[model samples]
Target: MSLSIGLVVHASRRGVFEEAVESLSGISLKWVTYGHERDIRPLVRSLVDGHALDGLLVGAVPYRACRDVLPPRLPVAVPRSSALDLALALSQAQVRGWQPVPVSIDTFDHEVVAEVTEALHLDRTRVTCLPYDDDQSVDDICAFHQRSLKEGSGYVITARTAVLRQLRGALRVLNGSPVPSSIRSELHELVSRVRHERAGASGFAAGVFCVGRHGRPGDLERSRTGLLHLLRATPELTDAWIEDRGRRGVLVLGRRTLFERFSRNWLVVPVLDQARESLGVRVAAGFGVGPSARTSVVLAERAAVRAESENRPCGYLMEDSGLVVGPMGPGGPPRTGLHRDQDDRDRDQGDRLRELARTVGLSTATLSRLAAIEQDLAGRTVTPSELADAMAITDPSGRRLLRKLHAHGLASSEGSAQTHRKGRPTGLYRLAIDAALTGSADGHPLTAV
Candidate 1:
C-alpha cells in the first residue's frame, strides 16, 4: 500500500528537504511549511487534524514544538543533521581559513560533536557545544553563541535557522544543517514501519465474548442475546462482523487495529464494566489474532474460556505467535501475560528477569519491554534514536535510558556506525541484558554473588 507521509518543515530549509526527497519514490508527501517557530504549533495541529497520514517527517525543532498535538500512535520520523553535515560545514569554514577547533556550536548534540572532532583529529577540548533540547529557546542558543564569541571563539556553527539568523551578523557563523543522505534513510525506515503496521492492520482478529452463568433457565439464550445487543450497541464494534458461535460464545471479527484500540492496546477493556453494571452478569472477552477466521476464532474461544475462570468481568488476548496478554480488568497498568507454552525453565528465567529489574530500580514491565526490544535487535548495536523509536519514547529519554543501561552493565558501547558517509558517526550500544539475567552468554541462570 502507498503511504501518505506528512512533511512538517520550515520555509528556509524547504529546498534541502525537497532535495533529499528526490531519491525517494512511491510515497505521497503533504508539506506543512511554517515561516517562524511560532507558526509551527498551529501548522502541525492543522496537519494532524486534516490529513489521514500513515507517517510524519519533521525536524527536531518542529517536532519539539508540536509533539503534544501529534498522535501517540502515529509513526513519526524526526530527521536530524548528522556529523557528516557538520563536517561539510567545517570544511567550508576551513576554506575560509577558519580552524574547526576553538569553535562554538549550538543545536547539535555533544556526542555528535565529539565523534566528528575525534575522527578528524581535531582537539575536542577546544570545542564548545550547546546541545538542543525542548527546554532550550532561540534566545538561549543566541546567548550561548554570544558567550562563545567573547570567549575567543572564531565562529559559531548552528543547525537552527532562527539561531543562524539571529547570530549571523554579529559572529562568523557556519550553517550546520546539511541534508545528509541519512534523512532519506530515516524516511525509508519510517515507510517500512508504516507498511508493517498496515500489514498488521489488515490481519484478521476475532473476539470471543462469553457471559458467565448463574444456573438460571434459558441462560444460553439470554447470554447470547445480551452479548449481541451489547456488541451491536457499542460504536467501536460497529464495523466488526458479529456472529453467534455455539451456545455461549459470540464472535466479533475485524481488523487487528480495531481490537487493539478497543482493548486499549490489550491493557484494559472498558466494556467489561458496562456489561457488569447493566446486564447484571460478568462478560469475559478474549481476543485472538491469526491468519484466518477459523484459527482466530478458535484461539479467541480459548482465551474467553481462560477469562471466564476469573471471578469478575475481564478480558485476555492470545495471538497466534504464542503471546498471551490479559486479565485485562478495568484498571491498573497492563501486565504481559505468560505464554501457554512457558516451561519451567522459561518461568525461572522470567523470575530472574524480574529480580534484575528490581535490582536496577526499574519496573518489571519496563525491563520485559527492554528484553523484547533486545530480542528484536537480533544482537545488533543500536543508537539512542533507534532505541527510542523501538520503545515509543522521546529521544532524550532514550539517551537517559542508554546511560542507565550502560551504568547498570545492561548495555555496552560497540564503537560507532557510519551507515552513510556524509553524516556524523552514530554511537551504537550493544545490550548485555541477556548476560545480566543469565550471568553468562549461555542459558544458565546467574547464581547469587
Candidate 2:
C-alpha cells in the first residue's frame, strides 16, 4: 500500500512546496498538503483521525510550533535549514553589493552561522549572530535587527520569514528557506521508519517458563544448570533469561507461530517429558501475545503463574481478550484463539512521544523525566521551581525547558501563583499530555491504531 503523508507549509511558500512534491515523485506516496502554519494542529488532527496519514512532513513552520500540537505517534519530519540554504543567502547578499564588513544575522543557530562564516572566509568579529528564542515576537526580532543596523551592521541576514517580510525594504534581507535536498532526505527517513513500524505492529508472542527439580534438594542445583544450558542452546528463542535463582523462572521471547507449532503437536510436552525423565525436573510454561515487548512480558508473567497452578508439563497461551488456551498434550483439542488489536493505539502513542523527543532533540534523560512527572502528578499543573527540583536543574534551566515545551505546544502556562512576598507572580504550567495522546486541545480519547 502507498503510504499517506501530510505536508505542512505556509501558503506563501507554494513554489518551494511544489518543488518538494516534484522531488518525491519516485516514491509511492499520497501527499496531503496543509497550506497554513497557523491552522496546522487542527488540520493535522483531522488528517490523522479522518484521513489516516502514515506520517507528516512539516516545512515553513518552525519545529517548535508543531512539535507539541501534533499527536505523538504520527511520525513528523521537520527539515533543518541546511548549509546550502545559508550559502545561497550569502551569495544573494554579495550580489546586492551588501558589505560583509558588518553583518547582522538573526534566528539561525550560532554554530551553523559560525561554520558558514568560516567557510565563506568572512571575519567573525564583524558578524553579529542574534538567535531568537520561541518567546520573541516579530516586533522584538525587528527591533533587534534595527538596533544592530543602527549600531553599525551594514547588512542584515535573517532566517525568520516574518521578520524578513516586515524589514525587506528597510534592510538588505536574505530570506532563508530549507534546502530541497535536506527536505528529501528527511522525507525518505520518515517513510522508512513508518514502513518498519507498520510491519512490527502485527504483534509477537512471548512466554515465561518455571523450571524446578521434582526429585530432591540435591537435584535443584543440577536442574538450574540444565535449564540454563537448554535455554542457551535454543536458537529459536529470540530472548531468554533466568530471572530469579530462587524461583527458577526463565523468561523466553519468540514469534507466535513457533509457540503455536510447539503447542499443537505436543512438541514442548515431549521436551519437558525428556527433561523430567533425565534430570528429574518439571517445567511449567506460560505464553502471551501483545502489541509491544513490555506488554508481552507482563502477560507472560501472569501466564507463568497460571501454568504453575495447572501443574502440567504443557504450554499455555494467554489471549488479549483474557481467554487461556493450554495443556496441549498429545491428542489434545486443536488450538483455537483470537488476538485483540486493542493496545495498538496506546503503543503508537508511546512511539509518537519517543519520536517527538527525537525530532525536538531532547535527551533520553529529559524525556524520562517528563514521563515520570506525568505519571506521578497526573492532572496537577507544575511550576518551574517544582519542575526544576524534580529535574535536578537550576531555576533558569527549568524555566527555559518550560518555555521550550510551550514553544512546541507540549505545555501551556495556566496562570500565575501569587507569592506572599512583593515579587512577581510565579508562572504555573501544565504539560499537554492529552494533546500528545489525542492530537486535540479538547482532550478527545485516542483513536485505535
Candidate 3:
C-alpha cells in the first residue's frame, strides 16, 4: 500500500504548495486547505483517522491549533522541497568526492560513529570525535592534536572551528605540525552544505512570529536578546527583526548567505506539538527556513506554534506542506527544549542590519524600518517616518522598533535636539552613515567581503 501524506496550506500558495508535495517519496499525497479564519484540527484529524500518514506537510500552525488538531507520532513534512534539495546537495557533494565529517557538541555512540565513517568511506583512524565540556583538560587537547597530525587525518569536524584556532597556538608548542589545510577546507564546506540545506535552494528571507504574554519580563526579552546576540556573533547573518507589536517572540528575517557563514557549532533546542506536559516556567522554541520568505516564515511560525500548542519544546524543518516537529535532545525535558532556529533567524536579520548599516551607517532599528519600507514601497528609497507610518504602528512603537533596529547596526538618526511641537523629538532615521555613502571607507577588502 502506498504511504499516505497530508498537506496543510494557505489558499494563496496552493500551486507551489502542491508542487512541493509532489516532490516527496514514500507516500501518496493528500491536501487540506486552510485560511486565517478556519480551524485546522478537523482536517488534520480526518487524515490521521482515515490514513496511515507516512508524513505531514504543514503551513504555519499556531501552537494551540496544533495541539487541538494533530495526533501523536503523526509524521508530517514541511516546506517539502527543502528536504529534496538537501538530499540532492548531499548526493552532489558525494559525487564530487567530498567526504563529510559530522561534528556535534554532544557525543554520538561509537557504533553510530563507526557506521557513519563506513558509509562515507572516511579513514576511520582519521575520524576522531572528541567531545569536550566547558572545562576541557589540556591533556585531551594535546592528544587530539597529535592524532590530527598523522597521515590520513584529512578533516577535523568539531563544533567550533574558531575554538580550534586557540588550540592551534597551543598545539604548535606541544607538537610541530598543525591542522591540515585540506581538513579545514572540508570542514568549511560541510558547514556550508548544512546551512545550504537549511535554507533549501534559492536565496530567500524568513520571518518568525512569537506571540503570547509580552508583558511577562525575561521570557520574551531574554529570548530576543540572546537570539540577537547569537546571530550577530555569527559571520553569516544578512538581516533580522523583532516585531514591536508586544508579542511573545521576535520576527526574524535574512538570507542563505548569512546562514552559510554561521553553521558551526550551534546549540540545538526542541519544540513540541503536544499540550499535555508543561513544566512550571518551561521555555520552548520553534524554527523554520526555506527557499522563500513566505514559506520560511510560515514553517517557523508553525514550529513555534507547535512548541506552544503542546506545551513542549520543539524544533522543525519544512517537508513539502508538513512540519517535522521533533523531540528534544536525549535526556531533555519533553516540554522544554532549546531552539537553534530562532538563533539562525536572528543571525540572518543581523546580517541584513549589518548590510544596511555598512551602506548607510544606521543602527539596527533604522535598518529594519528601511527594509520594511523598501519592501512595502516595492523597492523605493523612503524617509524614516514614512517607513514608520507605513508599518501602521504608533510613534512610540516606531521609536521602540527603531531602537531595536539601531541595536542591530542597520540604521541611524539625525535631527534637532529640541523637542518637537507635539512632545518628544523624533529624529530623522536613515540608513547607517557608512563610507559607502561618504565614499571614504571604500576599497577595503574587509568591507568588500
Candidate 4:
C-alpha cells in the first residue's frame, strides 16, 4: 500500500483546511474529515476506529478535542501559526483613535484560542465566543464597535470563516488589519528556492563553521541578517541555524548538497566573519572537504573546543584533509575516552553527544554508545554482539537501539543472510546520513533511512 496519511482539522474552516491538504498533492495522501457532526464524540470515535495511520497533519484544533483521540505513535505535522500575525492583529486592535473601542468574539477551538492568547496576552473580557451565527449583519458589527467604544476597549472576535470574514471587514473600520503577507511570503519563497538549489548539488564540498565569544545579546540576530545579505550578494553558499529557547546564540553548519537546490550561498562565511570582527569578537572556523552535515556539526564542536582551549581573541578550526587550525589541532574524532577524561573533556564530549542526539533523534546515552561503536569499528569489521558488548548493552538492547536510529533516519537496515540463521534473513543496521539544518526540504527529509 502507498503509505496512507490523513489530514485532520476542525470542520468549521474546511476551506482553508482542505486548501492546506491539497497543497500536499503529488505526495501520498488521504483525509479523515471531522467537526461536521453536532458533537465531537463521533469524530473522536472515528479516529480511534480508523485503520492504521502512517502520519497525521493537524491544523490549529483544540488539544482537548484530540487529547484522547490521536494515537501517540502517529507522527504529526502542524502549521506553526506565525506569532507575527497575532501581534499585528492585536496592535491594530489597540489603536483607539482609528475606531471605537474594539472587541473580539472568537469561536476558535480551545487550542487556537490558547495559542493566540498566549501569543498576544489578550484579555477575555474584550472578546466573545459565538462560533456560528446565521444573521450577523453590518448593523451588529457596528453595535459591537459602539459597545467596545463605550467600554473603552476593543472587540476581539474569533470565528471560523464567516466570523473571520466579517471581523476582517468590521475590524478594518477600527483600523484593525492583518499585516501584509507579501514580504513574509517573499522571504519564505526565497529561502525555499535556495533549499531546492543546494539539494540538487552533490553536497557541500567546503563549509565554514564560525564560533564567536564575547558577542552581543543580539549577535545571533545580527549574524543572521549579515548572512542573509551575504547570501544575496554571493548566492553560492547555503547555510542553516536554529534560534529556539534552548539554543538562541549557538550556530550550526551543514552540507548544502543534502539539502534542496538554491541552498548554497558562498557569502555566509566571510560575511559572518566580518560581522564578528566588527563586533570585536573572535571566532573559529571549521572547513572540511565534502563533509556531511553531521560531520560539520562535529567539526563545529571541534572549533568551539579549540576556541575555548586557546582563550585567544578568536579560534579557528577547519578540516581540509589534515590542515588543522585552532587549539584542538585537527578535525579528527574525540581522542579522550569516557573512562579516562578530565572534567572539561568529558563535558565537551557530553555537549557533542547531546548535539548529535538532537540531530539524529537518539538519546544522549545512545549516541555516546554509538560513537564508541564507531570508534571500535573504525578500520575494522566486528560482529553485532561485539559492538554491543563494547557499548555495555545487551544484544536485545542493541537491536532496539538500532531500531530507534533507523526510525529517525540516522541508520539503515540491510537484510544480511550471513547474519541470520532463521527462516528469513533479519536486518542489520548501519549508519545512514547525518541530520543537518539547511533549508526546508533538508529540514524535513521525505524518506527515513
Candidate 5:
C-alpha cells in the first residue's frame, strides 16, 4: 500500500528535511509548512481534516501545538534532538574557530548536553542548557539564549530553526536541525510503524455500554433503548453492529480500526456525552480486543465493569495481550499493561508469574501482563509519563505507579531526566521484573524499571 505521511515542519528547516527525498520512495507526501510556531495549529488542522494520511511526522513544538487536532491513533513520530545532533553542532562550532564551553543551548535535553560537552572535556559549568518541552515557545527559547549571552556565553545552539532565525543577526546561533541522515532514518522508521499498524487494523473489537443509575425498571428500559439508538445514529459508528446487551446496556461489535476512529482512538467517546446530554443518562462504556467474538465480548464486559467503578461515567479497554487502557471519559485514566498484541504465551510460564505476582502483591495475570511490557521495552529506560502513555494511563497515575514500582523494587532508577528547562527532572527506570523472574523471587530487589 502507498502510505501518505503528513510532515509538519517549520519553513526554515524544510531544506534539511527535503534533503531526504530518497526516503520518500513509493510514499505520498503532504507537507504542512509553517513560518512561525503559531501557524502550526491551523495548518495541521487543515491537513488532518482534508488529507487521507496514514501517519504524521512532527517536531516537539508542532506536536504539542496541534496534538488536540490530530487523530489519536494516527501513527506519529517526533524526532528528538538526539546526542548526534548536538555533537555535530559542537563540532561545527569548533571548526568555525569557536569554543564549545560557555555555550548556551536550547531544546536539547540536559543529559544530552552534558554528555556532548563532557566528552569534549569542556567546562560543564560554563554550559547553560534549556531543555525542550511541548509548551516552550520561540520567544521562550530566544529568551534563554539572550539570558545566556548576558551571562558571557560565547554563542548559542538551537534545535529549532525559528530560534535560529529570531536571534541570528544579533547573536552567533548555530542551527541545530538534524542532518539529512537523521531525518531519513526517522522517516523510514515512521513508514515501518505506519505499515505495521495498518496491518493490525484488521483485529476484532467489542464495545459494552451500560447506563449508570436509573430510578425504575421502566426508566431503565427507556434509557437502554435510548443508548442503543444513540450508538446506532452516530455516524462514526455506522460500521459497527449494535444490539441490546441487557436491561440497561448495549453491545457494539466492529473492527479495531472502526472503533478507534469512533472513540478518537479511545481517548474520548462523544456518544457517551451525547447520551448524557440528550438521553439524560450516564453511559459507561468499555472496549476490548480479541481474535474471537466470545473472548472479545467477555473482555469488553469486564472492561465495562471496570469503567462503571470509576465514580463517574467513563470507558475502558482491555486487549487479549493484557493491556488495559481507559477511564476514557472527560479525560483519560490510569493504564498499566502491555501495548502490542502478542500471541498468547504458553501457560507453562505460569509458575514463575504466580511467584513474582505474590512477591509484588499483584495478580499473576497482571504480573504476566507486565512481563509483556518489559519485553516490549527491551532494555531501554522508561519514564512515568512514557510508561503511562504506553499503558494508556494518566500522568499522575504514571507517577504514582512509578513510585509504587520503585517502592516494591520492581524497577530500578537510572537517575532522573530533565523534562523541561525548569523544574525537577523526572526519574528514569529500568524494569527489574526480569531479574526476579529469572531467579528465586525471595532475593530479587524491586526497583523502578
Candidate 6:
C-alpha cells in the first residue's frame, strides 16, 4: 500500500517544498499539503481524524513550531538546518564583499549556531543567534533583526522561510534551506517508523492454560516441569508465565503469526497431550487476540473457563467479534478469521485505549498501571498516597508522574483533599483520558511528558 504523508510548509516556501516532494519519488507516496505554520495543529488534527495520512513531513516551519504543535502519535519528520547550510550562507556573504564577522542569525538555537560557527573556523563571538519562540510574533522577530543590525551586525541569516520572506530585499538576508539529502534521510526514517507502528496496531494473540490435577503432588510437579520445558523449546512463544505459581493457570503471549504456526504444527496440543499421556494430567486452554494486554487477559480467562467446561484437549480461539472458533485439536484448520470484523465493537474499545496511551506518549505498561489506579479510585479523585500505592512507585515518583500528566493536559488538579489535622493537605487529581484521546485538551499538544 502507498504510504500517505502530509507535508507542512509555509505558503511562501512552495518552491523548496516542491523540491522536497520531487526528491521522494522512490517511494509509493500520497501527499497532502498544509500551508502556514499557524494552521498546523488544526490541519494535522483534521488529517488524523479523517484518516488521510500515515505520517507528516514538516518541510519549512521553525523547528519549535513543529515540536510544540504536532500530535505525539503521528510520525513527524522535520529537516534541521545543518552546519553545511550555515557554511554556504557564510560563503555567499563573503562573496558579496560582506564581512563574515558580526553576522546575525535568526530561527536557530543559539548553541547550534555557535557550534556551527566554531566548526566552520569563524569567530563565535561575532555571530548573534536569535532563537524562535512560539510566543514571539513576526514583528518581534523583525524588530530583533533590525536591532541586531543597528548594533553593527553586517549580515542577517535566517532559517525560517516566513522570516526570510519578510526580511528579503529590505536587508542583506541570506536564506537557509534544509539540504535535500537531509530531507530525504529524515523521510526514509519516518516512513520506516510509520510502517512499524502500523504493523503493531493489528494486534497479537495470547493463550492461558489451566493445568489439571495429576492426583499426586509429585506427578503434578513433574507435569508442570515438562510443560515449562516444552514451552522453552518452542522458540515462537514470546513470553510464558505460571500464573499464581501454577495454581490458577499458565499464561502465554505471542504474535498472531507465531500462534498460527503453533496451531499448524500442533505444538501446544501435542505438549498438553504428552503431559496427559506420560503424567496422567489434563490441560484446559483458552486463546484470545486483542490490541492490548488487559483485553487479551480478559478474553483468555473467559476462553479458559469454556475449555475447562468442555474437558477437551483442544482450546478455543475467541475472535474480536465474539465468535468462538475451536475445540481446536491438532491440525484444526489453524483457526480462521484472525483479522475478521475490523469494526468489531470490543476491538474498537481496545484500540481506543491503545490510542489513549499513544496520545499521552506513555507506554502500554504505564497506561495499564494508570488504569489500575483509576479503577481503584472508583470515581473518587486520586490522592498522591493512593496513586503511589496503586502504581507501586515512591510517593515522589508518583507526584512527578501526576504532574507530567497534568503538563500534557491528560490530568487536571481539583483542589486538595480535606484533612482534619495536619501539615499540608494531599492534592487531588482527575484524569482526562477521553479529552486527551480526542485532542480536546485545553492547552499544550500532548508530547513526551
Tell me the tens digit of each residue's lDDT in model 3 across 210-301.
43444467666664555444434433444545343244555556663343233211222311121112312233445455656777777766
Best by TM-score: 1
lDDT of 2 by residue, 1-449 (tens): 57877776665665666676685653444444544456666765665677766777775344456666666556666565655777788888788887765777776555456658888899987777655455667887788777777864587777666777889888777777765665676688778767655553456766776775366665666686776666555444434333433547666666655554444311233346545655567877777777777777778778777667766675655555443444433222123342123234433554565665656435322454475466567878998888888766789878767755654556765767985588667778888754664566742211110
Model 3 CA deviation exceeding 4 Å by range: 1-199, 205-245, 257-283, 310-314, 319-325, 328-449
TM-score of each: 0.56, 0.51, 0.24, 0.30, 0.53, 0.47
Error of 4 at 179 (Å): 13
User: What tens-digit string does per-residue lDDT give for candidate 1 at 1-449?
Assistant: 56789998789888878888887888999999999889999988998899888888888778778878977567776655567888888898999998776788876655567668888898876788876555678898888777766865589888888888888778888888856476777688678767755766789999988877776659767867887887888777878999887677788999988886676455567667667766777788888888898888888988898888877788877767555665666532223453223333344565676556533434443566577668668899899899887666788878767755654568766678887789867678988887777778532211110
lDDT of 5 by residue, 176-251 (tens): 7778787887788778756645554787889999998779898999999988988898887898999998877799
Per-prediction count of colliding residue pairs? 4, 3, 58, 40, 12, 0
Regions of model 4 farther than 4 Å from truth: 1-5, 36-54, 68-73, 78-100, 105-156, 159-449
Each model's C-alpha lDDT?
0.74, 0.62, 0.41, 0.41, 0.74, 0.61
Q: Is candidate 2 or candidate 4 better by lDDT?
A: 2
> Per-residue error at 344 for model 2, in Å?
21
What is the Å distance of residue 203 in model 6 from its true position? 8.1
The predicted structure with the larger TM-score, 2 or 4, is: 2
Residue pairs clashing in model 6 are none
Which of 1 and 4 is ahead in TM-score?
A: 1
RMSD of each: 12.4, 15.1, 26.4, 24.0, 14.8, 15.1
lDDT of 4 by residue, 254-307 (tens): 354422122111111233334444444444443432347566556555645655
